[model samples]
Target: MDRTVVSVLFCFVSYVFQLASTEKNVYNFNGGWETDESKMLARPGICNIDVVDVSKQTFSQKHFEDYYAYVKPVIIKGSTDNTKFRKLCEKTALLERYGDKIVRLSSANTHSYSKRDVELKKYVNEIMKPQTLDTLGNETYYWFGDNDYVEFADLFDQYKAPPYKLPNMHGVYSFGLAAAGTGVPFHFHGPGFGEVIFGRKRWFLYPPEKQPSFNPNKTTLHWLMEEYDNLHQLDKPLECTINEGEIIYFPDRWWHGTLNIDTSVFISTFLG
Candidate 1:
């Protein structure tokens, strides 16, 4: 083979490789998923939780213990735009890397929560399609639950856990991918921290004092989705919108619910 020909072939291969790499990271909003704005729920016209910028303000341990550790809810604004989790969550990245992987799709009704197996690609494609106000959480909402999401570890590792995690609080951390208006009903759970990696999420929080009002008769995830409106009858609740790079910490025993206002990806860690 001629030296010149060999060099030309090498250069061509490099160019092709570079193009493929760039294509993988691209998120084409215009051509892909389109969130239905009208279907999105309006934010509660109330304020309760303290929103703070952790980057510019000092977030001390005492502050955590006093207000957030296991007592109240708080939102910490931090940059997640360049985090590994955000990179891997790109539509192209997920489709190219883990589309074929099989996972559980969790959907709930007034009776109980149920799960069905599906290819990740199929689930993503379905959620990306247009959503309706009626089907948002009742019929179309889905959750990606995995005890070992090794495929996304590359991105998850980028955000290290704080030095002061609750003792013995180790369990599966779930990643949620949903369309606008998709949400869960009012419910209370253990302490946990959730962050928005891609889009906006509205959180409706009710302190322990208001728990009785939101606790439905069925007491199941499906029931909550069906009867979530009952919560509106209650007085003002602590509400906040968590955007890309922002995280919300919920204390134990606090009743809360969430609604995605756009095509979104979220990561959450629960403390047992």
Candidate 2:
């Protein structure tokens, strides 16, 4: 290579790195990255009821049958076996062990693909809170997900995970916690199951064949407050409220969103 060309390339790479460093210092604090302020969001149609709940005593292969045969969602009451996690999931227990660790928090707004990092103790004791009438998603509630798989493995090591999974698919575990009224917005990926270990959660789902018409910038809280009840009777979604010890199964490519009805400790098994 020509010496002049090599020198110019080196200079360009150095400039790019310098620019990135400057931006990081200007825009972030406490191991942070981007905030939802500079992100886009989504609009929505509505929420309705169309999910099944089965008791653990009667839970069967038929539930699995329905899950795959119809690609329908099901809530299996008393289905979770997270005995150890339940004991270790309380605020004090988590803070005692993982307080100083850094966690990544995704904005709980539709299509707002931004994340920030903060200490776990700060989120538990300072940031997360139950929603009050005065505040909604606009106040910036962050949803914690995939908090360093390796770093937190010990925490989940004794957790008895959901027994059933999509056939022939490998299950990858993700654990998360969020404040009341906070949740991930509409999105879809490979099949998965989510279980709330310590609080209530409300889910809104749409099958893969029926793509929901929604704004890309609205948060789930905003949609729930403004559009959920007003949705046309004919266009309602498959909705369900799951309590602790219940698990919800959603199929591949299905659009689903969740709202924690309480400060929630949850885990998911994503099949791939």
Candidate 3:
């Protein structure tokens, strides 16, 4: 190849590298790329949520009080790791330890879904198989509301809840398991703390003030599993993904839902 051509190619490659580096550092902090602020920042005719890091051992009662009382949703990062919890909740461990235990598994399909009591082993077996149109045809395994704490005592004890104390609220912590492509539909309930122990989940939250924008006909449990893409036309939702080891706290009555990006295990406690 000609020397001139070779030199030109090398210059082009270096220019590309420099451009990439510049883009990465646009809002990077402390050698890490910052989370997308545009979606969470308020602009003309737009509403967004806030993201914060408590990984540096910073927790404030005042901050929690403000968000909780006001019903604002916020993403919290770096509070705890899920290594121990993941190991304990893995398929093999769950089968060997709690396989015989009876728990209720709810199907995610609104049209044909219902809750049924199945042994823990059977539920684990279903999730390990490949997900198919048939597997998710009538319904998919979307685990929630294991109200019996004694049944999951070992698994629950493995999670390390944030050190911050919630004021005068009482609720039960529950375990959730779901395979990739399965998710809970849009709904609202009490205030809660969710810790992801394995895999990641994309969360979409619409504030209570925006509740009227949701379709009244579709709010029922039967129709909620249907995704309403038109919501973005009304308002930009507060979006974030809670990955393994990260914890998220949202106040009561926030319309929130999740999609499992990967097979995941989650622990959540709701406070009213």
- Give the Cα error of residue 73 in candidate 3, in Å: 1.1
**Candidate 1 — which residues are off by over 4 angstroms?**
1-47, 79-82, 109-111, 127-131, 136-138, 162-164, 212-234
lDDT tens per residue, model 3, 1-272: 99999999999999999999986563232112113333221111222556667766555778677655456776677766657777777667767888899888776543445777888777767543323333442355557775467877877787677655457877578788765555665677788887777666667677777763443223222222344443455665676777667777777788876656556677887775
Candidate ranking (TM-score, best to worst): 2, 1, 3
The candidate that wins on lDDT is 2
TM-scores for every predicted model: 0.73, 0.74, 0.69
lDDT (tens digit, per residue) of candidate 1 on 138-163: 45537645524676666566654443
lDDT of 2 by residue, 1-272 (tens): 99999999999999999999997564332112112322212222233443444542555666676645246777666655666777787667777889998888766656646777889888777787654435444456564565697778888686777667555678888888876666766888888888877766788889898877665456576667777778787778888777677788887889997777656788888888
Q: How accurate is candidate 2 locally (lDDT)?
A: 0.69
Local distance difference test, each candidate: 0.65, 0.69, 0.62
* Clashes per candidate, residues 3 or more apart or on different chains: 3, 9, 0
By TM-score, is 2 or 3 better? 2
Number of backbone clashes in candidate 1:
3
